[model samples]
Target chain A: SQQGEEDPQALSIQEGENATMNCSYKTSINNLQWYRQNSGRGLVHLILIRSNEREKHSGRLRVTLDTSKKSSSLLITASRAADTASYFCATEGPTDSWGKLQFGAGTQVVVTP
Target chain B: DVKVTQSSRYLVKRTGEKVFLECVQDMDHENMFWYRQDPGLGLRLIYFSYDVKMKEKGDIPEGYSVSREKKERFSLILESASTNQTSMYLCASSLWAGRPNEQFFGPGTRLTVL
Candidate 1:
């Protein structure tokens, strides 16, 4: 079963604009991670934020996690045409098994030039 | 560099035929997983293996079985393919055992059952 649900199934924006996507999960999680997948390709790890952390940043990407609400948001600044892809939010549930990750439905972002 | 490779990028198989999807990871990770992605369902786990010859059922394991004969290779098998099984299949691997473990994914195999 999927623990997370991402909002805004699709988003389109011009290059150089900012893109933001949100995700909500049903149960408590140990950590939340973001991933990006190009068309017909494998997913690439973007960033990971632990439950104790509220905000994290890497380059143009920013991730914020709110444990109280069981939600997380990913923000991409200065989007480019190359940034067009599907973004997924995966959560590690509170279980002994560490490698198990439940992913959301994903948000597809199209960056037009 | 960590690399995960799938046997095929696209495959077409007839209904009721047996199908095999192979995945190999070069990073020697101890954990491997198989997932199927559909339009609205996102990604659903099919099976996973934590060690050689050790397999565990995932959320959607009814139509799929897995084999992990070696540490680097994990294979997903469809006993009898069906039209409803057409979807994108993904393989992933991770080094650790618990939460926050980052996974490396392979280029998915798009399967079509006709």
Candidate 2:
């Protein structure tokens, strides 16, 4: 079974709009990371937020973490057509176990020009 | 830039045939992972290695086995391919464990079992 699950399986929005995706997890985590994947390609790491940190920002991307709720949200501000991709959230277990990331199903975002 | 390379971009095999998917990372990372992606099931881990000759089973490792005889390369093996095993396979590598250990991924290999 997957430990992380994302809401809003698919989303469509216009350019310059803000797109938000939410992820919920089942267990305690040391940190959560977001990744973007283009069609038929591998994923690219975006941002990572630790359990001790409530929020983080990277360029126009904002990520908020609420460990108490076992959830996190990714906000892409000033979205662009290039941002149209599948976004996934992955959780790193507390023990820093090697390569043990429980990933969410992912949110597919389609940005219209 | 970190480069994780998979040997094939696409593969097709018959049921009961043996299949091997190869992945190599140039970053000299210590950890490597293999995952399968399906339409609605997302990515599920099959196996991972922390170092040469060291392997661990992930969430879905029933039909898969792995070999890491070298530090930079990892191989995923399907003893006997099954129809249910058809999916996109991804290979990734990271420096170590923790939040800061961002994984670099290869383009992936889409495998089909006939």
Candidate 3:
């Protein structure tokens, strides 16, 4: 079963605009991670926010985790055409071992130049 | 940088044929994983190994099997390929899996079963 579910099946935006995506999970998690995948390519890890952390920033990417609501949000600032890709949210539940993650369906983001 | 490479970027096989997908990690990670991606289904874990000669089943492991002979190499096998098995297969590796860690993934193999 999928532990995480990302909102907005798809998004389209112009360059320089910010892109925000939301993800909600069912169970308690140790950490939540975000990944990016280009067309026909494997996924790349973007950032991970622990359950204790409420917000994290990496370059133009910002992640916010609301454990109370079992949800997380990823925000990309000043998006570029290169940022066009599918974004996925994965959760590492406390009951899961060996860092196993359950991924969501993902959100497709299109940044038009 | 951690590098994960799959044996093939694409493969085509007939139904009932045995298929092997190989993955190698240069980072000497202790954990390796196999997943299949399909349209609207996202990536689903098929199997994962934390050490050599050890394996664990994921949510969807009925149609797939995995072998990890060495710490850096993992192989995913399809006993009898079916048309419905055609999808994108991905391999990944990570270190110190006691907690959540970033996974490094191969380019992925697009397999087609006829």
Candidate 4:
């Protein structure tokens, strides 16, 4: 079963704007990770945030994790048309088997030029 | 750089036919996974292997089996393909044993069962 569910099933924005997506999980997690998938392709790892970390950033992407609410959000700054894809957030449940990730339904972002 | 490759980009099979999906990783990662993606259900894991010749069933493993004969290769087997099994099959690998490390995925194979 999917432990996490992303908010805003779909979003449309113009290029050079910012896009923010939210994800909420039901259980405690060791870590949270994000991935992006282009149409008719596989997913690409975007970033990961540990439970102990509140926020992290890479280039124009930023990720924040709040264990108190068991939620996380991914923000993309200055989005581009190439950034159009479906974004997924996966959570590693509180278990010793760390390789398992329960992915959310995903949020589709369409960046139009 | 990490690279994960799949045997085919698209496959078509008949119901009740046997099928094999191959996945190979060049990074010698200790972890590998097979997932099926549907229209609404993002991605659900079918099986995962942590070492050579070791396998574990994931959330949805019924009607599917897996093989990990070597550290770099993992294969998913459909004992009897069914129409309901049609999906985009994805293969991924990650370094470090039992860690939620960054995973590299291959271009998925879209399997259509008729």
Question: Number of the top candidate by TM-score?
Answer: 3
Q: Largest lDDT belongs to which candidate?
A: 3
The digit string of per-residue lDDT tens for model 3 on A1-113 reads 88899998899999999999999999999999999999999999999999999999999999999999999999999999999999999999889888798999999999999
Tens-place lDDT per residue, model 1, B1-114, is: 799999999999999999999999999899999999998788899999999999989899998899999999999999999999999999999997844678899999999999
Q: Kindly give the stretch of ten consecutive residues in candidate 2 chain B with the minimal lDDT sum.
A: B96-105
CAPRI tier for the interface of model 1: high
RMSD of each: 0.9, 1.0, 0.6, 1.0
lDDT of 3: 0.95
Fraction of native contacts (fnat) of each candidate: 0.81, 0.74, 0.66, 0.64
Positional deviation of residue B8's Cα in model 1 after best superposition, in angstroms:
0.3
Which regions of candidate 2 deviate over 4 angstroms?
none
Sorted into a CAPRI-style docking class, model 3 comes out as high
lDDT of each: 0.94, 0.93, 0.95, 0.93
Candidate 2 C-alpha lDDT tens digits along B1-114: 999999999999999999999999998999999999998888999999999999999989998999999999999999999999999999999998643678899999999999
Candidate DockQ values, in order, are 0.81, 0.75, 0.81, 0.72
Shift in Å, residue A60, candidate 4: 0.5
* Tens-digit lDDT string for candidate 4 (A12-110): 999999999999999998899999999989999999998999999999999999999999999999999999999999988768383788999899999
Evaluated at residue A4, the lDDT of candidate 2 is 85
Model 4 TM-score relative to the real fold: 0.98
Candidate 3: residue pairs that collide: none
